[model samples]
Target: MSEEILINSTPNETRVAMVENGMLQEVLIERNRKSSIVGNIYIGRVEKILPGLQAAFVNIGQSRAAFMHVTDVCSQEKLIRLEGQQAATQSDVSLPPISKMIHEGQRIIVQVYKDAIGSKGARVTCKLSIPSRFLVLLPDEPNVQTLSIR
Candidate 1:
């Protein structure tokens, strides 16, 4: 089944419906004001690096800076390259040292994976995913596997 986004707007509110075939599968209502911030890409500057937490805070021109991890920094190819570079690097692929990967004042492109909840900042990732009706496209990944949909 193919899916499409149908946006309906009123003076007070805007409703977005995800339609599959001829029926509405999901409905998202935004009151002229509020919306979710997930999947937003921003060109951000690294504010601070916390080696203890294995993460970094990035200024994405928001009220709060986004958080990115070292594991999230390297692409799949980069991980493979690192593994091929040295035998010792293979074990560190999953949880790489953040300090060695990123530094303060570095500019990076980050996408919000999760929204800021309470006092915590947005969880960000360098990996970006584009979703389609039938498939999801990961630009950086080389291998493509077909998935069976039921």
Candidate 2:
């Protein structure tokens, strides 16, 4: 099976639809004013750490701070590396508590994997990944497995 892409562009917005066997498989839209921030990198200051939620909110120069859970803290075996069109998943990996791992006022490098939806902020991960046309560059992977291809 082969896929085709149809793009509809205008001054204010652009819509891209992927068609497989003439059936719409996926649709992505980018508005001029509101573009997606997924896959974007940011150096942010940890504004607050919630031990109860096992998460931290970092001010990444966005309207709302991004959210990161303890599991997304980038462990050796639990890291997610997506190449091509692969989806991310989580596995069992033990690590220290979020409170002990990250402190308030600490600066961390994070990558936004999800965009802000409704009233919630974007979700980020410390395991930085840069996706290109065919590869997802895992710059933060352990030195041994530095670069990962799908």
Candidate 3:
């Protein structure tokens, strides 16, 4: 595992330096004033549901609303359960509509999947993905599959 050691002194400033092979490859400095919201978990309230787009605008206590897609809402177990119900294999199937899965005014735990770019809002997902040095952790996945990169 690639372990990260964070050194912090004051509430005003924080620095994150990524060490690889005993050498610093990346350094990030965060001031108390400016920070990115990506990967933040929020207990957001659903603001609006758009069936036409199969997405919802969520309030994650940010300046602009965040966007949550239906496909990103379902858990891995839910996907498997749905796949089992259909005769279609995993490679041949797509998920069902998001409208059937989530409703408006629901308080859901969502993680920021993407940062807000320009006028666009941050992309949020109910399915949380945790990444480490060696592996990308999917919380709902039962089995860990390894892929060989060519």
Candidate 4:
């Protein structure tokens, strides 16, 4: 696999484009006013916990509370196949209940996985992952490699 990076800088903004195999993949933009916060780690307080949905809402100094699902809270031992690749998707592996994992008003570190859309807040995960130039690394998935060189 091969990749190329294109960066454009101006006085007001800086844009970084990543092209893989001559195809446009991702573009990151940073403006003078606001910077992109996706993939940023934050020490946040757990705002609310919903036992019914097995999820929680956390305040990470964002406009809206980010979401934390049960699967993201607990580490899974079993591995499942995703639509695209054999990455570890959450399975019915009998993980501990969310209530046992965390509580409201508690503080924990979380990472933003998805950006906030329209009226919805961002999606966060306790299991953080930072991508490198040629590798998509998951902390828990040490033995799993999602990409292959052609």
Overall lDDT per candidate, in order of appearance: 0.82, 0.81, 0.79, 0.81
Q: Write model 1 residue lDDT over 7-58, tens digit each, in one string.
A: 9899989899998898877677877655668888889999999888888999
Output the lDDT of residue 130, model 2. 75
Clashing pairs in 1: none
* Candidate 1 segments whose C-alpha is farther than 4 A from its true place: 1-33, 75-77, 85-94
Give, for candidate 1, the lowest lDDT window spanning 10 residues: 86-95
* Every model: Cα RMSD to truth: 4.3, 8.3, 5.1, 6.9
TM-score on alpha carbons, each prediction? 0.72, 0.66, 0.68, 0.64
Worst 10 residues of 4 by lDDT: 78-87
Arranged by TM-score with the best first, the candidates are 1, 3, 2, 4
Model 2 off-target regions past 4 Å? 1-8, 11-33, 76-93, 143-150
* Superposed Cα RMSD, model 1: 4.3
Judge candidate 1 at residue 3 and give its lDDT. 80
Ranking by lDDT: 1, 2, 4, 3
Q: Looking at candidate 4, what is the lDDT of residue 128? A: 71
| Deviation of model 4 at 98, angstroms | 1.1
